[model samples]
Target: MIDDFLDGSLPAVEEAVRKAAAAEIMPRWRQLATHEIVEKSGPHDLVTVADRLAEAHLTVSLTALLPGSVVVGEESVHADPAVYAALRGDAPVWIVDPVDGTRQFVRGEPGFCTLVALAVRGEVLASWTFAPALDEMAVAVRGRGARLNGTAIRAGSPARGAVLKVAMSHPDYTTPEEKAALLCLDTEGVEARPCGSAGLEYLAVARGALDAVAFSWEYAWDHAAGLLLVEEAGGAHATLAGVPFRVTGANVLPFTAARDQATATRIRTLLTAP
Candidate 1:
């Protein structure tokens, strides 16, 4: 089936994406100026030349690798929603955020990365997050276990009354689901903070930097790779609806152990309506 595409092509894809991202990003990362930073909103929504360059490189390379596919990109959408609507529905698609942590990148922080995903029809088939700055790559296929920098990973066992450490955002723009996530953190007595960037938030949970992650909503490029990484890292990652991770927003994702599954599930119940 398509497994070969992942087995044979994944390693190659990870390397190419990493090189492309680094080439377009690292040089401009705080060390030098690529372009003037522009704020999308309140100075947190940021854009830079590196983001554009990295996405451009990814789009070109992805076109070569899978000419039969179309690309759905973050910048394209930001530039114009029309670009998103114009994507070819006739073929598979690559969902990409050339640089997921734009604010982090602009701020010269290490939390930002390149997020890429391949989806057929409406289901995510494969995904990757290349954190070039950290020399780490997280990759995942539909059924294959997720891998971080090529190492096998799994979810940890659950715990009880866990002091869940979580990542959050200001409740202002957050959907009802996001608010519930923050509530769960407070209810569970876990420390929580707005870690910034969907990619970074998920990475922290996968690496044990945080115990769980609850978000209002996330797009495919934002959560696809990270979802796989968390699951592969031996952690429970599911939306409030308890669905396998999807790009849908207004959803809460909780990473917990077996012991906390019940608690996590209870909290997730509160997020179901949205």
Candidate 2:
């Protein structure tokens, strides 16, 4: 069924996956738990019941849809060293973060999302990021471009010497590059809202809300789906080194195509120049 669906031989199977994702997710969106959330990285890093449930739901349904495809979810494998081992094996893997913005979720913010991405041979093949709160899902394939809800999406603006909107992680834990980018880039427009997720930032850039986002940490499940969205949405993204995003384990400095990659290239060059 997986092969058939990938080969464009079964639309029903694809629809089944989509429906399963939504059905298994919506009801539990804002539901609370009786217990406190777990702290993965630190006090700011959060894990909730909704995260585990959504991931588990996706895993179970996708497993039935595509038998033999490996599944690595955020709630489970993040702490399991065995996951690293299994992921290094010779198999297609689905890297999912059922809830990408758990911090925001806990804060009753609707910017949280479900990230579903398929990586084959360590390369991202297809991605679907569902922002339940915004009723937006950015779906992208390698060659098919990207879309939100059923309409096509694209990125076509830049922020320079103007009002700029930027998103970042917690400043208390922000990386050096992220801080530098904020300081060095001067703009009249300041809509700097640092939420708990990179997925929403990427989607905003794709949909033309934010102008750029500089990540202080490495890329995770949150940004992979966003990377595809930005790339397919006609935006430009690269590491701090100015390298076009590939499978490298590097953090990203995402800028709009409206900047025509010049700003990104300049920033990357500035960051990497030593």
TM-score of each: 0.83, 0.82
lDDT of 2 at 237: 66
lDDT top scorer? 1
Estimate the lDDT of model 2. Answer: 0.65
Angstrom error at residue 111, model 2: 1.3
How well does model 1 score by local distance difference test?
A: 0.66
**Candidate 1, which segments miss by more than 4 Å at Cα?**
32-35, 85-90, 175-181, 248-266, 270-274
The lDDT values for all models are 0.66, 0.65
Cα lDDT tens digits for candidate 1, 19-99: 787688888888646446776666667778887788888888886776677778888777776655423355767888888
Candidate 2: give the clashing pairs: 163-189, 164-189
